[model samples]
Target: MTRLVVVGAGITGLAAAFEWRRRRPDDEIVVVEAGDRIGGKLDRIRLAGTWYDTGPEALLGRVPEAVGLVEALGWGDRLVAPATTQASVVLPEGRFPLPAGTVLGVPASADGLDGVLTPTGVARVRAEVELPPLSLPDGDVAVGGLLRERLGDEVVDRLVEPLLGGVYAGRADELSLAATMPALAAQVRGAGSVLEAAAAARDAGSRSRFDADGPVFVTVDAGIGALPAALVEAARAEVRLRTPAHGLRRTAGGFEVSVGTAAAPEVLTADAVILTAPATKAARLLGEVAPRAVDPLRGIPYASMAVVAIAFPVQDVPAGSGLLVPPVTGRLVKGVTVSSAKWPHLAGGEALLVRSSVGRFGDESQLQRSDEELAADVVADVAELLGLSRPEPLETRVARWGGGLPQYLVGHPERVAAARAAVGEVPGLAVAGAAYEGVGVPACIRDAHRAVDALA
Candidate 1:
């Protein structure tokens, strides 16, 4: 039997292991995770007698792999989706509604979005329909650059910054449009009109594949962690937690993966190596075997982020789905989701759940703040935005992800291509994770599938 050693038990890593088992049921595979438990980035915690998804609570409907994987794991009944389209986008002046039909940050459905944009701002956005898109070939360009050319600085600062930062923890100017949102970029490259693409996409049935209506974004009834737990369960205990890789070396037939943080690592050899750790960590372990891949792989930037989850009496909570804080608001938090509303089952009965995400890109102080400080900041933001006065949490829970979402810079696709080219230098090696192509859970699953095929 072939031995396949996987480094990191993140969603991508675990997905890789699952895919391997699926391809060759008799093949021996070992998934070494540094954390004491499985699910590296996805975590579930209970606070105030309710469950809260501490990490990656919800993903957009644009990606499909996440949902498919869940169903494949025999968890078909564990799906849930967002019901309403309500979102409060914070502006420098105040938080306002995120206009519908807006593709990315550009106003795709801005017939009456004057509340978010000024008269001049509205005119600037309207101009996008008249002017042609700044088309580029299939290559990476700064998201800021694209927005600046097509839209304007105001829209980018006021909306795009906060929205993308909330999800990717990246600066619009440095993040890669091609890597983060390739379909939107393709609209510009192909049709030369975002509006047209938006119209066409909205007209298509496949657009809602992830949502409840067409196919809204859905999480497992048990929580996002259920997907990972199901994956590990399906593997039948082939995963090893709390085992970090010290280093890795390429061999003739396979690669020898060094595990353990202590001196003299416990080396395990395998016919194939799938590294799904953060960009920096993956580059470090695979540097010697794939030096050319290491530089670009490491260049993929990530931001440290923290989330504060709070529980409240269901009836006492403010009545809204969620609110998004744009960086232009001069606030520390990126957004707040009324978890109780998005997926009611997570906190049913008499209590409500709320999750606030803070710190992204360059906000070191906010991301590094103490648990108490974070909870206070998040609470304050949520209370003010939701019109709740003197809102106190029944229980406070905090989770910090060091170097969270990767910053796919202007040349990310090139870097990813270069990384793949370098990986080609070593046989039986592959990369899988949000850093490579996609950031949402579905994209990660899709990336994992690609890696498994490569290994096979």
Candidate 2:
């Protein structure tokens, strides 16, 4: 019998374990986690007799791997799509409708920039057509830098910043285009204009196999937290919670993983090991066997953020999925998701739920405040955005996720490849998580599957 040890019991680790058992049932699998509970970031919080997700609430349904895993887990029927794709952006006056035909708030056409862009800003966008063929650098560039060159600073600040920030929890100017938005990056490579390239790409995608009209995202009606819970339950592997992996070393036969204190440490030898923890944790564990991988892993930075879920009467909640706050707005709250309007399952109750997300890459000071302080600040932003005066909520809850999202800096793709090569030098070792390929649920699942295959 073969022994497989999967470190870190997050979705990625659990998914890898589950896949291993499904394919090789005879193999003994053990999942070790430092935390008492599983689901690293996917947590379910029950408030006012209803369930809400503290981490990611939805999955990119367009990703086949994500959908396939959910259906395979018998959650196909319970899958729910966003009731509406419509979203708005917060401005000085109030919330304004996000323009159509925009990719991550980069408008493909200048027609919808009325309320969002100033007269001078609109002129800068209109000049894109007349502007000479854009010259892009040979390699990866910051998303904001590229867009600002074409669309002007105002558009990048008012539109592109928030949309991209909402996804990676990092400023657009600092995020790498190749790692964050490859499609747009490709378009920007040789295109004469950014808007023209975006328009062409959108048109091509609409006419391709991609379902442009399909639901962009989906989630389990109960909550996304259920997915990981079901995964852990179904995997039925030997799960050791509150037991962290302390050390790793190569052995003649395989590898030895150390846990607990050095004085009375327990070591488990395995033919294969899959590390699915964050970059920092994974780096520390690889110190003995794959020392070279540690530097690159440590180079990867993480951003912390907090989510405040508040419930109110249906009438008090704003319409639409939610509104994103452009950095130019000078707002503390980054974004807000009107849960009730987005999902019917979250509606029909006496109270409607709204979630406010705050804190980002370089702006984590807000997280230093107490939960009450954070919740109060977010509530004030919500009230002001919705034009409600001192509107009290029926209930409120705050969930803090320190080091939640990973920042994919420039040269990320090359860095990831080099890290993989360094770890691959050590036989029967692999790493998986959102830090590598993607941050969404589907990306994590797909990454896990690849890690499992690597062990084979």
Candidate 3:
């Protein structure tokens, strides 16, 4: 048998193992997870009989691979888009519509931004449109600096950061546009100004049909975890959960991994290995094989965050999809998803669900907060942002993800290139996750296919 070992049981790993096995039925695959369950971050938590996805709640329809994979696994019927465009951006005054002529992070002329911005802010932003776009080599640009130079600090502060916060889970300065969202960076390069690009798109009628095609987000009835579960079921590989790998050494035949348990550690040899763990963890594992690659992998920074799911009476919450809070005055959170209104499937008629995220590169103090402390701060902030007073949550569930979103800092593409180059020296080793590519479910899935193809 062509024994291949796949590490980690997250969505990326699961999809990889499934695709690998389908292509090579003779290969014996072993999937080991440090935790007792397979779905690493993809999980659903139930509070008062209602389920909420603590991990990625939706998959972007922009990427066909995710939809195709779900269809292949017979999960097509489970996919459902939001009924309306309740998604809005939160401003100092109140919640405002995400503007009409904006695509991704770009706006259609500074005039369109007028809906949520002041004339002064718009003028300041317009000045940047005339300035030249970047001339750097093909690599990730610091989205923060790029936006500030091209749009204005206020635009980056009040508009761009929140839009990006939801995706990168970090500060604008800490994220690399090339690594996180190259499409947005490409927009900057192609049109000199985000406004010009969006205007061009609008003229072409390349607008968002949110209600029909899904409001930029899609999910299943059982929860987002269904996708990973389906892959695991399809693969039927040897799954050893709670069995963290402690060490590894390249034996004469292939390689031996130390599977550690409280009782004892067992050695298992495999002909090939697929490392789907986080970059830091993978670096520790591959240090012996590739020293140069391991250092930068270890250097990649990650931000801690918490997902707070608050349950409320249906009438208590707003009548919109979600509210994204810009980082400028982002007191407590990055955004709030009005779950019951956005996706009725996940809500009871009498109750409402509001999901919010707190703590990024700029808010380390909040990242260190205890669950109760964090919940208290969240309650206060929600009240201010959503216009709720004396609103104690009926049911609140909090999940803390430390070192969750990797920070693809400026010059990240170059570093990633160096790491990829050094990786050629380490045979039978490959890495995949949100850590390397754009931080989205689709990006991870895309990397999974790429890694499997490279290995095969």
Give the number of the best model, judged by TM-score: 2
Residues 1-456, candidate 1, lDDT per residue (tens digit)?
A: 898888878898888888888889888889998888888778888666655688887755545677668777987776776655477776767767677666566566457668788887778877777885546655567878877876678778877787788778888888887776665665656665655655554545354454545445666666787567878777653787778987888777778898976864688989998888888888998777888988888788788888888776555444456887877677777888887776757545666678888877777777666788778888877777666644766777888888778887888899889998888777899888888887878788888899998878
Candidate 3's C-alpha runs over 4 A off are: 132-140, 187-194, 197-215, 261-263
Question: TM-score, each model?
Answer: 0.92, 0.95, 0.91
Q: Sorted on TM-score, highest at the top, how do the candidates line up?
A: 2, 1, 3
> What digit string (tens of lDDT, one per residue) describes model 2 on residues 6-62?
999888998999899888989999999988898888988886688899889988876
lDDT of each: 0.76, 0.85, 0.75
In angstroms, the error of model 2 at 31 is 1.1
Candidate 1 regions with alpha-carbon error over 4 angstroms: 60-62, 132-139, 191-213, 316-319
Tell me how far the alpha carbon of residue 444 in candidate 1 is from the true structure, in angstroms, after superposition. Answer: 0.9
Candidate 2 achieves a global lDDT of 0.85
